[model samples]
Target: STRMRFGRGAASPAGVLRAIASGGGTDAFRLDGVDHRDDAGRLEVLATEDLAVEQIGYADVVVLSRADACSPEALRRAEERVAVQNGAAAIASAARGEMRGPSTLEALLGLRRADFVQTTPAKATHHHAYESVSLTLDGEVDGERFADFVETEVARFSGRLLRTKGILAVAGLEQRMIVQGVADLVEITFGEPWGDAKRTSRVAIVGFGLDVGSLERAFTTCAAS
Candidate 1:
């Protein structure tokens, strides 16, 4: 950037325009990127600062990444902030290598999430400093208690919790309960039937500085007792 006469730490205007331009096509999605950590809250895309706001303003989506890093209130504020600049664009939250809300990969790819079979994600080859906990249960869980746990205790640790996704075997529900959460925001939906598959409940939590024992204990307590 220095050699090109742009600010020392800032992106080149031509580069930003060229990159955003490359995303154009009838089938393409114009995404205005921001992070809930700072950029979203500030409603600023430093990389595109020098470029005309109109150049990047025409977007089909506003991607707010790292939403798990912020509180529910913070996320709400970030959305409002982003909307000030890109009010027409749909908002999407991304976390834990998967989209947490609408505008997911499948949606972008023109596919329905329910059309695919849910499977355990393959183990990653690399590891980061964050801690991950996986628990399995052969018995059914108490749906109400699990929902309360997600709304309360689990949400209380949002700052350090990156993601919590699981296949829940609810005591009376015949179909599997699929849950995915980031911070205090969680989405739960009924999935396909167990069929011939074993009735097992598996929950995985990924985060930084997580108290494994406490989380696991509290999690198990949601069992139908």
Candidate 2:
């Protein structure tokens, strides 16, 4: 990540190289070392910026640490990377205790229509369907089956997924429900219909990680009416 660049006012390459060679990790990148008056007066570790964030884009695992808020530029750059990586990275704050504490599935109980934020891959795309729909898996869909379907879909689209959300109408459940996922995490919830009228039981699956044609096909072909 280290790179050589002439400072704004200074033209001596020898001095910059000498400082870089002698400076420790902390001293190597310091605001004081770089002339504060001008923005481009110090050597920077480009890879440290790259290494600052890590992204995980798979089912069965969603690990987000607290190192995303390094700086506005850093976080902004990291987010851009996340969107491009297509759901490989989860939105996180590098500052400790800055979030609403650690995440727990407790909030997902009876949840429906979840919205996702950002990721490490910055440019991750998303999918949406406005019409009401339902899912009819043969018998019941185990966690493994659902994960497999999602993984296949992610790969098929090369990781363009940001968030997935929709209502799931189960054959046996008393009330309509919701299911959602961000990055690698997924959840299902139960809830009453939004309106007094009974909502059409439908499954709406959205994707940002890849072309949802396959997902749409899968749901349409397999879901129960």
Best by lDDT: 1
Q: Residue by residue across 37-63, what tens digits does model 2's lDDT show?
A: 111111122212322112122111222
Mark the 10 consecutive residues where model 1 has the least summed lDDT: 109-118
- Taking every candidate in turn, the Cα RMSD to the unseen true structure, in Å, is 15.9, 15.9
Compute each candidate's TM-score over C-alphas. Answer: 0.46, 0.32
Report the C-alpha displacement of residue 113, candidate 2, in angstroms.
4.5
Deviation from native of the Cα of residue 174 in model 1, angstroms? 0.7
Candidate 1: lDDT over CA atoms?
A: 0.53
Give candidate 2's TM-score: 0.32
What is the lDDT for 215 in model 1? Answer: 69
* Model 1 stretches with alpha carbons more than 4 Å out: 1-127
Clash totals, every prediction: 0, 38
Candidates' lDDT values, in order? 0.53, 0.35
